[model samples]
Target: MDNHDLKEDPRLPYRATSRMEVVDVPTIAFLAATGEGDPNTSPLYADVVEALYASSYGVRAVAIEELGRKHTVAPLEGRWWADDLRVFSARDKDAWHWQMMIAQPPWVTVDVVTAGIERARSRRDLAEGGRVTFTTVTEGLAVQTLHVGPYDAEGPTIARMHDEFMPQHGYRPRGAHHEIYLSDARRTAPERLRTILRQPVEQSEPQS
Candidate 1:
């Protein structure tokens, strides 16, 4: 059987331009783990991400064995927020709360995820695996843009999205700031990395 690829799905937008655009996102499920702190320096972040990947691969293994099919594991994605929205513009990494996840194919249900977690626990140091859960997120109306460069350099683009674009377009931020890592940081140069920056939004009430 041919391996399924999430990137080919229209619901999953892997390619985007630097220009900001509006898109309607459908409800999607993910294997997710939530935590706080600087992703670059926090050990918790590292552990959670490892757990997500391990569980994802485990799910793929289970699928191949039980369903006789396989899928290309999607890229790592994140949802970020903080007590104060300004922290994002200030680049306060330590104050950030985040959920890192890997989107699974629709065929991978809750039972499959549970089985995957169990399998991963037996083979890896997934002290954080228990934190990983199958969750669905409905972004609905959202604005997104492709950000090219280092992770730290994304602040300006994000600011433009939240402070300028949203207001100009009569929308308000409604959910966590989201990011899709399209390039592997380990091998890609900081200047060449590509990321999709997204924010869920709602139409603003008309001024009195």
Candidate 2:
């Protein structure tokens, strides 16, 4: 069986550069869980991530054994926001809201994913698994750039995009901050970690 990987998938713009560029992101389905708190320190965040992976692996098993399909688990992605945008710049993670996700192929139906979650639940007490749901998002137009180094050091790049590039290009932010984790934090060095920073945008109206 062929191994399907998101990194190799042309449909996903997983490859990015330090240069900012505009891209149209198509609607994609995901197994996702939403919560609020610091990803670095929140217990809920850890549980959510564990639940996502467990469920995704479970889904892969069902797909290969029962549906005759096999694929590598996709990268972890997130959409983050806060009641006050300043909280992000201030590094006040406790005030953040986020949705963490793992992509799923079209063939993985909701029922199949549910079964996967059920399998995970049978083995461990992942109450967060119950929060996982099959969902989709359409981020039509967006600007993206590659960010390297520790996740905490992204402020400058993000400020440039939102404060300088967007205004200069007549675009305005439209959605929550999105990030695709391209490097595994568990095995990769923090300074070498790769992440794709994406933000949905819309054309700004001309002032009268």
Candidate 3:
């Protein structure tokens, strides 16, 4: 989803949010990250995906610009996709910890998913029509949200985040907020939509 489309979406709870996370990325992944939908519905680009899995490195805390994405969203079945995906591994003096997942290296966002997926198929080439774009992200503080609900109900949670979570948690949005969608809307139940909204944050007044 692009910026304008994202803003017009009704599911979006807030303008945007950021977070604190240690993306424990392994080898870069072909289609390293995808939000287009129906992963199983699409052809598996095994070879390229495998290679990306084999060549990733240590984890790092990089800012992510997350946006909500929903296709044919019903009352309960909406999904979010982080667009304009960017990454930049760096060092930080602060201390925080969280789970990490294998991700494409921050600098190599390209149209490799279609190319790799095409190369993997034996007979059918479905082709990669939608791929999460990855690129370089500058370091800084940001804001985010921790949403819990059906994809359709995320708006209220986003409101909670924008109003209560950020302010009480000592955060102010520095840029476009990010969302770490931990659940698959296609598979997960509507009542059990699990998502992590990550926003950049720092000591508002020197952490006194």
Clashes of each: 0, 0, 19
How far off is model 3, as Cα RMSD? Answer: 16.2
lDDT of 1: 0.90
Q: Which ten residues in a row have the lowest lDDT in candidate 3?
A: 57-66
lDDT of 2: 0.90
Tell how far residue 180 is off in model 2, in angstroms: 0.7
What's every prediction's RMSD, in angstroms?
1.0, 1.1, 16.2
TM-scores, all candidates, are: 0.97, 0.96, 0.39
After superposition, candidate 2 runs with Cα above 4 Å error:
none
Off by over 4 Å in 1: none
* Cα lDDT of model 1 by residue, 126-201, tens digit: 8788899999988999999999999999999999998999999999999899999989999999999999999999
| lDDT of all predictions | 0.90, 0.90, 0.36
* Per-residue alpha-carbon lDDT of candidate 2 for residues 1-208, written as tens digits (9 for 90 to 100): 8888867878877789999999998889899999998899989999999999999999999988889998899999999998766566566888889999999987899888988988888988896988999999889899999999999988888888888898999999887989999999999999999999999999999989
Local accuracy of candidate 3 as per-residue lDDT tens digits, 98-170: 1122333233234333333333343333243223223333325444444666644555555555556667766
